[model samples]
Target: MRLGAHISTAGGAYRAFARAREATCDSFLIFTKSNRQWAAKPFTDDDIAFYKDAVAEHADLHPVSVHAAYLINVASPDAALWEKSYLALREEVERAGALGVDFITFHPGSYMTSSEQEGLDAVTRAMRRLLDETADTAPNTVVCLETMAGQGTNLGGRFEHLAYVLANAGPSNRLGVCFDTCHVFAAGYDIRTPEAYAATMMEFDRVVGLDRIRCFHFNDSKHGLGEGKDRHDHIGRGQIGLSGFANFVNDPRWADFAAHLETPPTEDGEDGTTIDMNQVNLAALRGLLASSSA
Candidate 1:
């Protein structure tokens, strides 16, 4: 399992590699710039060199993926916001490629005012255009659409939404999905039992093809099935529980997939003083594997 957390890129973007190494992460996610803001100073040549060197030094942290800015809303019914979001996403993809990151994932965005169909089409079109514009620039980095908790009118709560986006993008360009366990549960795909987990995965495979799923955001939900809430809890401590994760963790099919934690970090990195929640959660996941295989 490629296990890690969303580590901070506070001092410099390249520092995230060292932090991943410190956390004992095989892979991790980081925001190349600010998560809340759109404007960034740009990644200088030195910055790229340092990042590449750090990544090379930590061979285990090979596929450090970028999480796109939080403010992007390409599904916005407002034309101005949509355009701005499209441009920002394009910039994000380009930057991630330049840094030689493995993947860049983004929220599928909300379709609040417009009809869901229109919103899906809008997002799909934007993806196609972004891929076209960054064809040569960002060819290596895969653009992944993340599964979302069904908060308000977010587009990716259902598996179909992601399938539609991929269908429109076609097979040639770089495209994929990031399946979030908590979001699927909040959207009503139960995985607490073996039978239920199999059923849910079968449905996903039918609609989107499991091969298209490149990464897993391993989290537990604070809410129950179909709750539409977006709260993430510690692994095994939430409603989804241990069995939900065990089934996925031990599956032979996804043996090589990355399972990343978005759980809250230990305050001030104090262990004994403050718990390393990531280590705790990762241990919980590791414990599940034996039972699942048995």
Candidate 2:
């Protein structure tokens, strides 16, 4: 699999490429804009040129993706906020397309006080509208709906939620799924053992057609199964231990797909030492591949 992490676009958008390249990654993800902010400065022609040039410089960065802002809520019951989210996501996709990003991940949003069916319908409608707005350039990009931790009334926690979105969306191949291991485990799909992992995957195949899944967010859950928490921990040291990661890393079906680490970033502490946790987590994942090799 092509493994990487979410790199910061702090200094400039193009810097994310350099960061990922320095990490010796095969792929990487970025937030096109501040993930907590609702508005963003438009991407200039220079921005696009710089990003393209960086990608050309780093031939190994196969697929650079963007994660949508946390504030977007297309599934909200509030009409004004829902429309705001639809436009926000539409803008995000436009920005990603401009940057030559082929993949973008977004949470399917929460229902708030609405019923589950209401939330599903809202997401379906918003998706249709968003797709319609970007139909011209969407062929170059795949919008991935991320699996959630099922906290509160969040959508896409269940495979059924994903199925509903796919079934209701416009007939477009650009729509896909991004499976986060931590969220999947926290949402009650067991992956800590061989039989359990196989069973959980089989269920996904049956309900969501594993074909729709195109990427992975490789995080171990800090909470236990069925906890519905969204905590992420470094690989092996969490509730979903190395056994879980080994089962996933060894799965031949996802060999060509992109998997990225969303674990906490490395912080510089007192001494001259640095703590890049992604390296540790990524090493653990790679070790699983060798140890589990047949």
Candidate 3:
């Protein structure tokens, strides 16, 4: 896997490349605008140029992705909120395309006050419309549906949910999945052992073809298996121990895939030194690779 982190774009989107390089990232993820708000200042032509130039400068970074704003809920049953989210999501796709980003991932979103089928149907409609609208403009960019922890009415806890969206939304290449380890584990899919990992992956493949998975969110769950919570901890310090991660790190199938760390930024130690957690997590993941002699 190409190990990395979700580097912040606090200043300009171009700055994320330097931050990713500092963290020793092989690739990275960034939000095109403020994640908390729906409104964004339009990217000027110079802004897009600078961002593209930075990406070329860091040629080693493969498949740098964008995470959609948190407020987007394409699955919302409410008309006004749904329209707002769909519009925001559409803007996200356009921005990604304008910057030549390949993947833009977001949660499938909460059903809230509706049946699961209704929520999923809403997501399907929004995805279809989004893809159709951006077909000519953003042909190369794929919108990825992230796996959620099944908290509250949030969709995408099950593989079937993802499969449903993909089946309904596209026969288009623009739709895909972003698998999150912490979310999947919390949703009751086990990967704690090699056998468990194999089984879980097999189930996912059966329900939703492995080919649909385009990116990953590498996190460890603070909650246990089947806990249905969304808290994330450090790579091996959480409920998903090193062994579980080793299974993913050493997998040849995903050797070229980008997995971004969404874990905490810094950790305080006994000596009062602040540790760079991304470096620590990357090292831990890299260490999982089998020795040549083994």
Q: Ten consecutive residues with minimal summed lDDT in candidate 2?
A: 285-294
For 1-294, candidate 3 gives per-residue lDDT tens digits of 999999988888999999899888999999999999999899999899999899889998878899999999988999999999999999999999999998999999999999999999999999999999999778899999999999999999999999999999969888999999999999999999999999999999999999999999999999999999999989999998888999998899999999999987788988999988999999989888987315
Put down candidate 1 lDDT per residue, 212-289, tens digits, no spaces.
888889999999988988899999989999999988987888778887889887855434487778778877888888
> Alpha carbon lDDT of residue 234, candidate 3?
90
Q: What would the per-residue lDDT of candidate 2 be over residues 151-176, giving only the tens digit for each residue?
A: 99999889999999988997778898
The weakest ten consecutive residues by lDDT in model 1 span 267-276
**What is the lDDT, from 0 to 100, of the residue 60 in candidate 1?**
70
The residue pairs found clashing in candidate 2 are: none
What's the TM-score of each model vs. the native?
0.95, 0.96, 0.97
Q: What is the C-alpha lDDT of each candidate?
A: 0.87, 0.89, 0.93
lDDT order of candidates, best first?
Answer: 3, 2, 1
TM-score of 1: 0.95
Model 3 error, position 281 (Å): 0.3
- TM-score-wise, the better of 1 and 3 is 3
